[model samples]
Target chain A: MFDTLAAMLDWFGIVVFTVTGALVASRKQMDAVGFVLLGTVTGIGGGSVRDMLLGRLPVFWVAEPAYLLTCVCVAFAAFFLAHIPASRYRALLWLDAVGMALFAVAGAERALLSGTAPSVAVAMGVITATFGGMIRDVLGGETPVILRREIYATAALVGAALFVLLSLAGASREAGLTAGFL
Target chain B: MFDTLAAMLDWFGIVVFTVTGALVASRKQMDAVGFVLLGTVTGIGGGSVRDMLLGRLPVFWVAEPAYLLTCVCVAFAAFFLAHIPASRYRALLWLDAVGMALFAVAGAERALLSGTAPSVAVAMGVITATFGGMIRDVLGGETPVILRREIYATAALVGAALFVLLSLAGASREAGLTAGFL
Candidate 1:
């Protein structure tokens, strides 16, 4: 039951990241292929890096094609939906926040499972939560949020630490995720 | 003596990758900061991914500031040298080849040292050699070579296999690098 919830959250995080990345690429006036590339990278880049760091095999996306398919679908949606006159910037921000929160908690858990120290796990969580967006921004020729004075990576780190503390305190994963996200 | 040679090759690879990335960014009319980001990512991105996969700590460029410093210097050079009209495409292709060869040999050696199987080590070598450029291209709004019907990844894989084969035959590191590059 717990595993199923965690897996769902992971997939949700990937979808959120993909949407954010697709939006960014649309704002940059990239073509469809470029949008898909950015979206996929934003969805899986950080976790791929984290898995590699943990010496895990095959990479997460390669083992499961669902993540890549989600990114592609998001990219397609962005292509048609970006024509709407709505405030996409706000949507992008919210989706990015959700992705950051979910990815941070999940990444920290994975790091801990891989035998990393608490501090390192927290750091890896932040990296896993943010590095994909950083790559997206860099590739899109924009300054990454980390390079800005925005409350980006710091937020992820705090959320990860909170989740770890809660887990150590015998709280449920759901409780920990809620606390971290909140 | 071999350590000194390895260090030199490592620095050379860093410089080449950085300069190439900066040149590409400049052609795209990006700012100085953009050039630096692209250059650094192109230079250290592959090795960072490789280290993460092998479960190495601190990452290579993060632990050794020399790589970062070399990239900075190379980026500076590229900023000034961009005015010259010496076939950017050709330069990019050849520089990529050199970078790929060096990375393939280095990655295979590192994977072997980390106790990976020969086949996995070769795959790691190919990933290390190609993934940086793949990331660079994707971010630059270009098709990644891996997705293209090019001989690029094939070259890297062949090089990696050659390096592993030579090493298994008790050849020196120098000999392996030479054979792999050739």
Candidate 2:
């Protein structure tokens, strides 16, 4: 049950991330290919880097084309959505935060499952949460948001650490996930 | 003999890449931390990405701290050298080209040794040759050098293909390396 929930949330997070990527491209006056490339990279770039660092084979997106397709679909949708009024910028921030929270816990859990130390798991969680945004900003010709004076990476670090501590305290993984998400 | 030569070239390339990264940081007026971060990423970023895609564990710099140290040293040196004059820009470009050529063949050879198909190996070589500069450009808030109309990625592509073809035609690996370098 927890696994299913996590998978669902992961897909949801991908959608949110992809939309933001596309939105950035549209704001930059980029074409379709730019939107798709940025969307795909922002949605999957972090987890792919994490998996590679852990030596997981076939990288996540390579093993599953569905994820790549989702990124493309959402990017296309965002291309249309970008025509709407500018107030949606506020919605983007909130959506990004929610997605970031979800990914942080999931990344930590995956690290723990893969037998990483608690510290490493926490770092993985943070990386998974923020690396995509970092890549997105960089590709968009800006400094990474997390590296700047944002409350972003800090939030990810705290949540990931909380999750890892809970797990190390012998709490159920589900309980840790809930706490981290909250 | 080939192994030794490859190793030496790899280190030389790292120094060149690191210097370029540091020079970019200087041009951007970044701090020490930025210089180090950019330098390290540019120096090892390509091989690290390739190894991860191939499921090679721990990434190269993570497994061997020496590469990271070399990047740091070169970055520090470049930080000071950046103030000298504008004439060094010419030298930087030549060094970058040499480094790119060396890394292309080395990346291809590594992929071939890891048992990937020749096509995949060639792609890996292109990636290894181009990825570091791509990352550095992104971090420095510029379009990637490869994405622009430069004789850059094309050079890496030709070298990688030449090396792979030479190997397939029953030439010694050293012969392939030398031919690819030229």
Candidate 3:
């Protein structure tokens, strides 16, 4: 029913990931190239891996170069805006959680549609939700947040599992999506 | 002219890369899971990305699951044998160079076969030869060899460039392959 809104949220997820990637590069005092590289990779790495794993050809960003362009711009701008307010930083954190959860459900859905086992679909969800950030941190020479923390991937796990279970129970996909977000 | 030999060399390249990855993970003191993860990804990451970008479906490893099994075995064994003699380590380093050169030429050849421009083919070559190690270091929280030194990717770049130039000059594909390793 809210396809446009869902699309907007998905776009926000990419932006949020890009911003975080750029911010992390700033923290590392990396050069402009570094900032852009980290940002673009963080924004798209997880989904790209997921698509590749599922044999989705050309991956998403290759099929849609605009996503790559948007990530570059967002990252370049972030280099200058690194001193943004702490309040906005807090807001970003909140949005990032929403983004990761959304990604988890989305990844599982894709895997299920591709006919993988439920267990593997759940793994796909966690990988989609957290891998981009993990890669960003790795490139920035830091330990990945996924390995350091409990909550990040656990939340994605819960969402992915619930989505699969709900789908199995013959619930509408829309309802499962709502449950994941909640 | 020596297709069988070339294929064998290619296989050796994968094994060498896997060993290097596992060794790096061992040096990082990562667990067994980490060793396997690093080794497998390092062995396959570059080519997988190349395929995805070129829209090659199902990826090579998924089509040949034996590659995955071999990587896992090699990585696990490396965990126990990490303390091997420095001479062996030196041997592996030399093998790695051969592997990288072989991969660079192989990658360019693949891209060229797919009808990409010579320039893009060369880029594909370097990406194929180096991105796996780059990902391995990033995952290990070490600065990537590609970023820290001038030589790592320069070697790949040279090999890739040579391969493309020779191919364009109407030399034998075999000539280009020879040049890459030389």
Candidate 4:
């Protein structure tokens, strides 16, 4: 039951990241293919890095085509939807935040399962949470959030550590994610 | 003596990566600052991702100012030299191959020392080898080599596995790298 919920959350995170990436690509006047590329990278780049680091096989997206499919579908929708004035940047930012929070918790959990130390797991969590956006920004010719004087990496670190602490205390994964986000 | 040699090789790799990245930026009509960004990312991005995966702390460039300095200096040089008829795209491709080869061996060695399995070490090696170029291409709005019909990732994987195998058979690090490259 919890596994199902976690899977759903992961899917949600992927969709949100894709949407945010598509919106950014739109602002850059990129074509539809470029939007899809950015969206896919934003949705999977961090987790792919984390998995490769942890020595996990097949990578997260390769292991399950669902995430990749979701990203593609979301990007296609966003390419058209981004034409609407209602696609506010502020809303995309908020959604990206939510996605980041969820991905951080997921990354930390995966790191812990890979037998990494708590501190390392926390760091991986932050990497997994923020790296997609960082890649998107860099590719879009914008300064990465990590390179800027932003609260981005710090927020990811805090959220990841909080999730780890909650999970170590025997909280459910959903609870841990909620605690981290809150 | 070996340490000095290793340091030289590492710096050489850094310079090559930085030059290539800066050249790409120049072709894109990016300014000096854009060249700097591209150069830095190409030089350090691979190793940073490798360290993050190996659970290493602070990342190499973040720990060693010299690495970042080297990249910055190369970027500055490349920026000023951009007006030369360098046929930068071809040069960038070849330089990228060298960087990939060096980084692949280094990353595999690090992973092996950290007690990762041979297969995982090889994967890490590929990540270290290709990730920077992936970042460079993506940021430059080009398709990543790994995602293309290139033999790039395969080359890295073969080289990394050879390195790990040779090291396990008691070959020196230098010998392993040479064998891997060959």
Candidate 5:
């Protein structure tokens, strides 16, 4: 089912973001607790914000403990692997891009399911894709990379909007999502 | 009416927090944009997070533009007044405490109105009281005062819990709110 696929993608995105958060924390020489906190927030912050704005109760992570466990485990893994070559950051960036793409589609799809207008759905997608990273950067005392360079937010916005338009044009849900993800 | 009184308190709290935010920006010698952004975030962050978690749409400032306007104006004013004596930080701290008290009560009341469990309402109150400052500190690259020392979050939590208990004991809403505020 599409819901199952979506959930898988969501989990994948959370793991990717969590690792990125842990990487950042390790670079800052933060303690284990700091790594876990950063990783957890970065993994869940965006979707949590979106759910809150939608008046959804029992935030997604709170409702599902699996996500929390995954983040914690990933944080610990990343912490121990912090000495991996600097090239790991390049991999992190690519993973972040994939995560952002999936999260954007997921956010837009959720907003549409909630009966929001198309524009709102698109906006929600951008928020979901970007907020986690922003929060991570802020908490780590770095200016958010999204605001500096790169078309990060722009890519998410376009992807979400494209998905919405494709859906409106009667494309299959999977097709629309795939197109957006690409 | 109770609504009017609540609105007044909310506005007062926003202004106080905004000023505190701008003061932080000034202390850091940030640019004008920094001042406004910090001020606005510190003024609205807690309530916005609370609303998002509660599934409240559009957030409060989005529904009421006046709060946004007030924050912008106050931020600019505070930026210019940054040269005021060093004693201003102390005054700002006290004002922040008052804002925290008011916001904590308001947050708890709103959560109760939304039918959240009493403990959840108290948590929301603490979040609404502290999150804005945390965001400001994080973005400004300063450690959040709430995490360092002081009874900041504890005070908010206690106030919210007291309000809930008083209300459960059949106190008038105003009396419960006043008790929490004090």
Candidate 6:
């Protein structure tokens, strides 16, 4: 049940990030292919960066190509449904925040499992939470939201640190994850 | 002798790219640490991207700590020596171009050695040649040079493709490298 919940949360985070990427593509007035490209990259990019830093071979999406297919389908859905949206900007921001929190906790868990230093785990968590959006924004021809003097990254950092510390202190994984996500 | 020369060329390309990154930092009027960060990232960023795409475990710098040290030392030297001002803009452009060519061939060679298809090899070469500058420019708060209406990427693509084709046609590695670098 723990693994199942964790996996579901991870997929949810990815879907959220993919929606955000496709929304950015819509804002950029890109073609369908552009939406898929941006969305897929945004979905997998953060985890890939974290894995590369931690020396995890094949990254995750490479070993399991289902993630790429999921991103494509999600992005396509977003692209089509975006036309019917009335006020997407606010929802986009909210979804992005939720994705950030989920990824922060999940990334830290992976780092801890890898037996990295506590600090490295925290850093990886923040990186994993934020890097996908950075790539999306950069590739979408805009300045990244994190560089816009936003407090979002700071929140992620604090949350990630708290989670790692809690894990190190022998707290249950579920407790730590909830604390980090909250 | 071939191995020695190949290694020397690789290091030269790194140094040249590092100088361009430092020049970008200088243009941005960044401090010493910022300069170092930008320089080292520019020096190794392209190769790292290539390694990640090819699923090369540990990336190059992780497996060989010496590369990181080289980047750090070179960046520091660049930071200190940049004050000796002569018009550096032209030198920066030329150095970047040379570095791009060298990396293009080297990256293709690596991709082919990993048994990727010819097209993938060419693509990797271009990514390894250009991704560093893109990262440096993006992080330095500027649009990437590749995004500009420039013939640079076209040149990189042509060069990379030619190198891969030459290798596929049974030309010597040295010959392909030379053709690509030219």
Candidate 6, position A47, lDDT: 89
lDDT for each candidate structure: 0.77, 0.79, 0.76, 0.78, 0.81, 0.80
Worst 10 residues of 6 chain B by lDDT: B145-154
Model 5 Cα lDDT, one tens digit per residue, A138-162 = 7776668686636777788889999
DockQ of each: 0.08, 0.19, 0.18, 0.06, 0.15, 0.12
**Model 1 Cα shift for residue B115 (angstroms):** 2.4
- Give lDDT tens digits, candidate 1, residues A15-51: 8898888888888888888888998899998888777
Between candidates 2 and 4, which one is better according to DockQ? 2
* DockQ of candidate 2 relative to the true structure: 0.19
Which segments of candidate 6 are over 4 A away from where they belong? B1-47, B53-133, B136-182
Off by over 4 Å in 3: A1-45, A52-109, A115-130, A139-141, A145-182, B1-7, B87-95
Maximum-TM-score candidate: 2
TM-scores of the candidates are 0.59, 0.63, 0.62, 0.57, 0.61, 0.60
Task: Tell me model 1's lDDT, rounded to 2 decimals.
Answer: 0.77
Whichever of 4 and 6 has more TM-score, that candidate is 6
lDDT, model 4, position B163: 90
B5-119 per-residue lDDT for model 4 (tens digits): 5456567777888887898899999999999999999988888877765666678888889899889988988899987955877777788888877777777876777677676
What 10-residue stretch in candidate 3 chain A is worst by lDDT?
A: A1-10
Candidate 4 stretches with Cα past 4 Å from truth are A1-182
In model 6, state the lDDT of residue B47. Answer: 90
- Please count the clashing residue pairs in each candidate, in the order shown: 3, 0, 0, 1, 2, 0
- Kindly indicate the candidate among 5 and 6 with the higher DockQ: 5
Rank ordering of all candidates by TM-score, starting from the highest: 2, 3, 5, 6, 1, 4
Q: Residue B68 of candidate 3: its Cα lDDT?
A: 62
